[model samples]
Target: MSEPESVKDLVVVDLGVGMPSAIVAKFLREMGATVWRVAPPAGDPFESIYPAYTSWHSGSRMATPDHLDELLARADVCLIGGEDHPGLEWSFEGAALIAANPRLVVLQIAGYARGFEQRAAVDLLVQARVGLAFEIFSDRPVNFACPLPTYGAAIQGLLGVGAALVERERSGRGQLVETSLQQGAGMFLSCLWMSIEDTQSVNMRNPPKDVWAPIVRCADGQYVFFVPRYNGMDKVFAAFGIDKSIGDTAKKGYFGDIDLFQRYATKFTHEELLRACWAADVAAEKVLGPGECWDDEQVRVNGTIVTEVDGRRRVGTPLTMRAVQPNSGAPRTSLPSAPEDAAPLAGVRILDFGAMVAGAYGSKLLADLGADVIKVEPLAGDIMRTASYPNFVVSNQGKRSLHLDAKAPESMDVVRRLCATANAASHNFRVGSAGRIKLDPASLRGYRPDIVAVQCFSYGASGPRAMNAGLDPLMQAYCGQAVRAGGRDNAPLWYRNLYIDYATGAIGAIAMLFGIREQLCHGNAVEAETSLLEAGLFLMSELIQCADGSFSGGPPLDYDRTGFHCTECLYQTKDGWVAIAARSDDMAARLVNVLHLQGFPENSRSWGDSERQKIAERIRSRTTHELLQQLEAADVWCEKCNENGWQSLLDDPTARAANLIVETRDPNVGALITVGPLVSFSRSRLDANRPMSVPTGGVDTREILGELGYSSTEIDNLAARKVVA
Candidate 1:
């Protein structure tokens, strides 16, 4: 456990709960920062419930809020959580703290932003407000068994803080950083929000016809999940003794006659089916529930799960960077003056060969960090330009675009030449596609032996479905996420947001950063691999567990006609809907007092069916404003379920203060307002407020070629030959 040289002397103050703040503390600690965690007098609320809490705050020294001022005076960074907790008013306190400590870096995590900053929200509430619930359950809103919103936000928070730290290295100042569950939800479903086409408009929305659905019951009553590549479908059909002739047509029709295939699938046991599928080169895996993941061979081999010294099982960080060490030290608050024109990653150069949201977003992240990114595309442009312009804009910002037909010998030479000069290169092509274009790690390494290479695939590099084409929806269906979220009685549903894709993008960015760090430290290049499937598994890590008899699934679904639970979900009020959380004993007691429910028990579970019904009725009897006032005054967590559009966020003072939304004019889209950068810096600021406009295909082709030292005559000849655009 050697510490990273860059963060060797950093000190961080961890405030609030374990969720986002603790998660941030964990990452910094891993990077070699000494973390001092400030817990409330009653102790951290999640300490007893979430095992990850202990894992994240492992080496941090714990203290009460009384030491907050002293800690801040010596801290390089401070992570604050508990936006909804009544004991802390972060908005005002944060402002005061920053005023007092001009160089302090404060990162705050909240449920929502703007005018609703004071409102209480958890993962479940954020998911419902952002359309995840409606997408998962057609009848009503249901939270995933896990806390995806918070986890996703936590990842972004880490990235935001890291970027700010990079900026601080140059500017010698610290700034405030903020992120929220709502923002995380947007990133999770970046594709859905940006795409012009809605999922419901397609015939594939029906679960029966969803070609991506992978769960199939075998003869032995066991279940297996598999994803077949375009060409592998024929082998799958043949293994089941079905005519391969129908494979192409079935695929075109989104798995035509699903029932017939299911009937045929029943002939083999789960193990037999998996064996046959693997023999035929189809990627498959057993449908391991949350309780069964611990013993999984692949999971263990990948170090995705680890048993702590205390014997508690915990999830491990997916990305690995061996060159960097993990140790403990206090960071230096001041350093030598930096260059006036310094950018966070001014000296780094990256070659971008990705399309669609995942690869493009990863490159965009690098570009935002001040890396010189050159985007390589085909003559037809990235396919996503036509599929979703908004997505293209968001993912292609701050990069120079070039078009090259890799099939041509001249284009292949140009790509190799580019790789020689680049510090790193990234692509999201299906498994074998990179090799065809001579952009694979081996080929790129031939040009620059120490160059970093990053590859993103749908499934993974070694899985049976490694070469298969996949998207967010498909991965969700295959990983049992759709089934778990949809519940046992309902049809598996796909979340409209391409959360897995964006999450993969975030992970990809981290991997690239690690690669850069490795080169800086060890003077060696590294190749990193990540996939949508792997990211999905990581997101569900906290929930996956083995049931050892003591495991009892939390309270049964308290589904009402409106699709929310009475005790801990959204309820209709006189004016509008309000989301409330009164599941805990203290909160339940407060709710009982506020609503004047005479006979309702303070113990949440003691309430009978009739009592629950009475509470719902009483809640509906009052207006949203009245209920919010009563609940909030009584220290209960609640918020109005905002159904407004993104435009409304612009008017929020807190959002504006934090620079959460930026407005920029674009040549193609006219005036544009997009989500701003997640973090802020005092002396140096990354302007995410600018429109991330998409450049026309080959818009900078000649310019980039000129930089590559290609002669004018050669460039013209290549353009004439249709090799360069």
Candidate 2:
């Protein structure tokens, strides 16, 4: 392996128009790269009003005599985002051209793959390209209004680019990489996965006393969350203001059973009961709405929520990297800014062949960070364009869209041309027949050297189910999540939202970053891979029987529900509900005190034995609000489970101090809410925002083609052929 002289920044040469391209471009700029917008031949031009600048190379369109040669000659890396339109053969031609490139990189945007179908396609592409490429899959199957999932994938691509670049420094070569959507989805289903194995053990043995509590409706039309650990149970019993002995056992009388707790819960308003519980230091919380999450003290002060808008705040990045001493003599530059026009990856070029949530959202995240992502759409455009999304603007903030038929020779030619000038290209094909859209990474190298390609799908690109059609719901059922959610019952319920898909995207971003770091270490590119099944296994690791470890009798029954720890659950309250987890003895004792119970029951029953029913019957009567207040005041470990509201979040000043929201104006959408760049660099400062304006599909085609040296007449002729869609 030979290290490159230095890390050369990426230069973007956008070929299409849409939020995807804009997003990719935004990422480049944030990374302190340069951007050179390229106008395609058929776009509707309004040059004077646009803010970006472009180079004119009219004569060098895709497959033009020396187009590939010139692009590779001038650029260190090429990037691509989104996919080309259908009906156009350009995507296919582009695939071959890119496989031929020696220096270009590709980023695939397929969100989630069912089974292992996507993985197989990626493997084939890897074999064909014989160069560097990788896949990004959404954690789960998703159908949302906005492109929230795209953030996950875009961040992953940016990280991948960095890693691939580092690898190029080591091996002086590149390889193909891919991720599985099913795996991505599996990553986010951690809770459910753990429940499965727990339940399995419990099914084998039954106990008369159950400790877990369910979410119950309150009289105030609100919900409350509560949990009964040792102390909390005692507190609830004490709150009932009784020392009644259930008989049997030690010094006195006591009983442990869900029925006992139920009897007590029914006596008081949820709130009144909660106060008694809170005095005891129970783990509990009220559910919060999206906005309320921002206001959460933990969220606000923990620096986990980054605000990108005045009114919109979201979860922040949870990881960071420690910088190593430089091995080379080159001095480090200051942290890059995040401004739309002057940020890193500004001039970096990318070719996007992704669709739906996973691939598309991945590119979008990059755009937010200042990368020029060119979304090459099929004739019909990305399916998301017509998706029944509730938040369409979330993912499409900064990107450009271009429509081209990947199957058409001319369209493929266009894709080839774009790849020739891209720093990387990407694709996200699901595991089955849906993966037909993937391009060979090695083949792309034929058109340009050292190119990076990112690919994501359903299953692993190399597994048994590599070609199966997998989606979120299917993944849930297959992974044993549905079963866990249903508890003793076999009937499973699908989660209302596509959490797995989004989580996969997020994890993929982290992988991409790691891969890019490796590339920087070697003068070669590295392939990064992940799978849905692997993700599922990871999620359920706690529940799965390890090859080397013994089950040895799970948790104590007083706190366990089969495999489920019934103690960590939601509890009804007076005003609402709270989610709580009482795990320690101290916590349990505090709860008892808060409930105002004094002398211990005469019964010799241990903390979590089956002889504590008298305590259960007492706490059931209080209201959720009162319980939350009491618990919170006592510093109990708990929180509210928000079904969907934001009042509390918006009112939290701590959230504002944590930089959970930042204000920025968009060129295209005007003033709107945006989420995070959710990361904080202790050593390097980061500054970037979405662009003010984004282009629509084919909006700048003619102008871009003109720069490529295409004669006006030729440009018009191509439009007549409907080659540019």
Candidate 3:
């Protein structure tokens, strides 16, 4: 009720005329900031519903208002998440706005691109900027077509904004922070770069490229993605119970050739091979299909998959930050939008009906920031509930749930009633005629005139695939991600798991925050939409740029293996193998100087791939401990590459320090390791493992009925009829 005394009370603004902005606004509010949004001028609003369609503006058509400079100066943080083509009016203006905001912190979430225009575009927004400009994309790798996590980028984008605001207080100046969806997507495909660089080749023609971490189908027809490290191969060889003679690197030239290792790996059944691989700490896991993650013990225990909707739970967000101990000398960060506790979206609520991974996760993130997220599920629950792999417990933590078959008449009635309640007045806002929840624009208008509504359908709520079912995999196919993933040649391969789902979730959350911001500051509905297709393309923007040769700060893709030297590739040892990431000349010298190794090879063409293998073979003759000690002593950022994404805190000290994973308790699933915060915030910290106290589907229905002043008998009748989950 009191005026906000901190930064959380300031209003958020959504410049683009769409849902992504709305999502961003919603999250900002929940993070304790008021939001203000800007829609397209009247009826001439932008037509595209998806961020994918909206983000590709390349040319000069992007708007550059006469008062743009003033607008940039007025805001603390300005985010540009759309296209950079010069042909579009908005693109040029967006870039110009970044330059104009001398004191403003700007974040450009774009992809890696090539060509002069693309490079110029990068320069305009990111290049040579005072602050950080991050690129997240999926380059050409064995599993390049997988969904990238742009949704998380949105979270990072907002986090960048918050960080900028905090920095502004101390420095009295603003800095630029830029990232691209393509860059984020690229992170999923980094192994390709690792391989290209590791093999001491300018191009991807290295021997390792000849080999693949393939998912071989067993006689039972089950598939498992496998990529064995050095030690894993020995066990894999032993697992098939065969004598492949790959154990020692001294006699043969097998150490450098990954493809050679695969020849032997393909001999066993998929299941048999996996057991062997696991026993040897090789990177091998069943290629989880959609919805399959829910059934995994890791998913259940980690609280990634969860129960929802009349007792049928599904996958939710994978990141959580717990509440900070009150008054621990760590002053709570304040937002100008709302008062201290009320500072960040203190009284905001979100209704999420997204069935797939991305949308579902996006809503979960808002909840993490303190929004009351009511996860609306279909009668059968979210499709993710029945997803084959079923890792819902890890992603779906800490949220209330409700179920309604929107297609059914009675269920639709319940939805309408709930929407009506959302439209109604609350203590914080002026008493409204309607409540907040609404299925239609008209209903939302009457409900909370100042509220933001986030509708996260797969391809968005309209157009060709408006009614068509959408998810990460299909979208990857549609957006050319699968095609580009194959690189200049080769066949496209989709990355295992719900890749696009996580990305879409994060983007959806950004849109919600933008919409909510628009509502609180200059009350109006702010709509933005993002799809897997758009997100995929957005994250890979640099790829487009690179293909066109318009990127900057680095040469266009070139291939040269000469002048290369190092002990950086995967080294095999008798006990186990460890990957070495020590790649600098100094580090290389340190590896030789500190380890005090023998048989260091001399430089020359004579020491090509074949010779390089000879040196590696000699090194592998030692133990992992010996090599690790040598690298550690040299102070290189060396880490044993756990090809599998299963490194525990104990195994990886850095992961522990970054708080990448945590132990969380789930109502139905119990305690398990869940992924930690993607980005950390000193204050306004949400629990990494917040308790999901709301019953799967009990609270939403009960709360709504009670608020509608429905009698207990009526509520019981509805429950009996199964109108609510």
Q: Which candidate has the highest lDDT of all?
A: 1
Residues 1-725 of candidate 1: C-alpha lDDT, one tens digit per residue: 13234454678888767466666676567556689987766655566445456676777888777887898998878887743443433433566667888777777777875345434657666765655444443333445454566766777777666656655555666777667777666565443333222323222122221233555778998766665454536766766668766545454544444565678879999889888877877666665444355454544544556555655565555554333221223121222344654445665788999998888888787776667789999899897776556667668866888999988988877987897678789999887888887898778877776667888877677644566566676566555565555444544444545677777888777667656655554455567777886776666544423233232232223434232245666677877766677646778788888999786666665665677677778888999889989998997777666554343455656655654555555555555555555544444545454335556678889998988889999899999999999
Top-TM-score candidate index: 1
Ten contiguous residues with the weakest lDDT in model 1: 201-210
Model 2 regions lying over 4 Å from their true place: 1-349, 391-395, 430-438, 488-490, 518-521, 548-567, 596-620, 643-674, 682-689, 692-695, 698-715
TM-score of each: 0.78, 0.49, 0.51
lDDT of each: 0.65, 0.39, 0.42
lDDT of 3 by residue, 1-725 (tens): 21122335443444543222333444454334544443333321223222222222221133334545555567665655533322234432444655666556555554332111232122112211101111121211121222233443454566446444543443455555544433333223222221111222112221232333243555455555544342334654554454666445212332333444445545666677777766665555544323333344433443433343334332233222111112233222222353332213334566666554565666655655556666776667654443421234334555667766555556655655555444111111111211232354445444334334444444443344344345455554444444444433333334444456666566566555544443433334443445554454344432212223232111111111111222433344556544443333445545655555445444221233564565466666777677667666666534332333333232445444443444544344343444444443322344544553323444466775666577888778877877765
Instruction: Choose 1 or 3, whichever is better by lDDT.
Output: 1
Q: What lDDT would candidate 2 get against the real structure?
A: 0.39
Cα-based lDDT at residue 297, candidate 2: 42
